[model samples]
Target: MPAVTVSDITTLARIPEPAPSAAERGVRSVTEAPTGFEGEGFPVRRAFAGVSHTDLDPFIHLDQMGEVEYAPGEPKGTAWHPHRGFETVTYIIDGTFEHADSHGGGGTITDGDTQWMTAGGGILHIERPPEALVASGGLFHGLQLWVNLPRALKLAPPRYQDLRAAESALLSTPDGGVLLRVIAGEVAGHAGPGATHTPMAMVHATISPGAQLRLPWRRDFNALVYVLSGAGSVGAERRPVRTGQLAVFGPGDVVTVAGAEHQDARHPALDVVVLGGAPIREPIAWGGPFVMNTRAEVLAAFEDFQAGRFGQIPAERVPHGDLGELPTQPA
Candidate 1:
């Protein structure tokens, strides 16, 4: 939960309060994420599970990586994989992850850091914990979101962005009740560092117990609030929510969330990631790892990948067992 912090939150810029006349969004549905294992058997919560594609347009999938404390030799990550027609945003709240792609886009992202990769046309990449971390064993928690690209940009050149925690636009409420890290798009008048193909906003908020956070939201974007830790309520109706739950908000100009008066000792505050994006509204054909507008397109992507169109792994690229032996920090 130490993604970013300040000694005096009041010293940070404050998000302006929404006007009284502004319409407050209502909660459409609250769903709980199911626990599962991903990659090479690392536990994950399917954050977007059971949610309709229409409500998650522009967002294809989300996985809440372990909040678990790993013992020595227990750390795991994904093998080299191919992706196309989408972007993958990996934000680390704790621990470290090393990424290397066939297109020469790779880096190490730690607490509060982010690695954004646009697999516009196609790309091959792998993510795993560094050797030091695997040897020492430690806590690891993070989120990986799959953002769908519009049909027009499906074959665009790939790109990468490494966003450090310091680059996030940090803000607080007038009362210092919450700390918000804007990772992408605009919040109020402040913008995050991520450059996205689709119009979207991503914010990580830490709300003190008994505090309420109300955000001025774009009317055209669909809103969603996913709880990362602790207990809380969402929307103008104040529907009860807790860790591993996601609240989908209806159309409105303001989105509201409030922390419970009390929380479990393990999680002292309410932590949530708020996301919104302009709907793509186009047909979606998603297969394992690839997201395309049509099934035929998805099939073509698999064919191209099998035919070596995605490029080969670099010769110098170390295999998984050796990955930990590499430098933990990005050079």
Candidate 2:
């Protein structure tokens, strides 16, 4: 591991949108919400749980995947899409996903599976909805986060890591009602999920209502939280933060969440992701499906993709994934 640096660990958290007050709020219910500007075909849904990308050092985008229900027996496909200078991490909470990439390696990711892919330099891929979801018209819920690459690895080769849910080590603390699932980096005295290519921390936490979570913070790293499901409040922000929204916190000693009571009896848990890391601290030149450091670099990437530098996809190629299918929904 490298020594920590002030420039690398300094993070600023702000409540971009303060959570709603459950006390003053009226009874309400919401199902599918989507984020991200309109993507290509299929009306890229911002359907409603939160979707936005604030500051995650070296990371740019975060989309709260949904229970995308497709027609019976007809698999939903996102044709091929391209990405550069970043890696994509897909964490499945339920359902199944099948991805294929231009990098030449891909497989099915069922419930409890995680796929970390590096689309260094450039790659094209497609992620198709699992047939099971189409067959049963059930729910497909998960998250896909785009982690930007430091300048050093911007042009590195593309790669992938498929770790199953059962294989991923977990740390569950009943005392505080905290469930920490480590996707990368160390948490709660546990280590060795194989180091993430980027120096980062990705943890999925299920905070029980009235439970509290206090995580150590090192200056220089940016921090943000995505409320996955249920309603809850955060530090300095006692309002309710439900699905489909993000809480950008202000810099401080630690992040605190209190005064959240589950709305449903069967589901008394509040789910969210605590992601923070040193930012790349570089310019973001983004266009369509590509992200790079400069406009010129962005142009070059499109040229490569258009010229077929990255191979083509199969007949029913979907364009909603990065480098093909590792964790992309390239629609």
For every model shown, what is its TM-score relative to the native structure? 0.96, 0.77
Q: List the residue pairs that clash in candidate 1.
A: 131-324
- Model 1 Cα displacement at 289 (Å)? 0.8
Task: Residues 1-331, candidate 1: write the lDDT tens digits.
Answer: 6668889998999999999899999999999999999878999999999999999887989999989899999998887888889999999999999998888999999999999999998888899999899898899999999999999999889898999999999999878999999999999999999999999999999999999999999999999999999998998789999999999999999999999999999999999999999999999887887888888998888788777788668777745423323221111
The worst-scoring run of ten residues by lDDT in candidate 2 lies at: 1-10
Q: lDDT by residue for model 2 over 1-331, one digit each (tens)?
A: 0011123111312111122421221112223445543223222324224323344456777666664544577445565677788888877777677778877768888776888888898877667666566677655667778888877888899998887776655555435366656677655445426357777777777777777665554345555666776677766546457766566665554555543765466346677777767766777787766778888887787777767776666545433333432322221
Evaluated at residue 41, the lDDT of candidate 1 is 93
Off by over 4 Å in 1: 321-331
Candidate 2 wrong stretches, greater than 4 Å: 1-54, 68-71, 174-176, 192-194, 312-331
RMSD each, Å:
4.7, 9.9
Q: Which candidate leads in lDDT? A: 1
TM-score of 1: 0.96
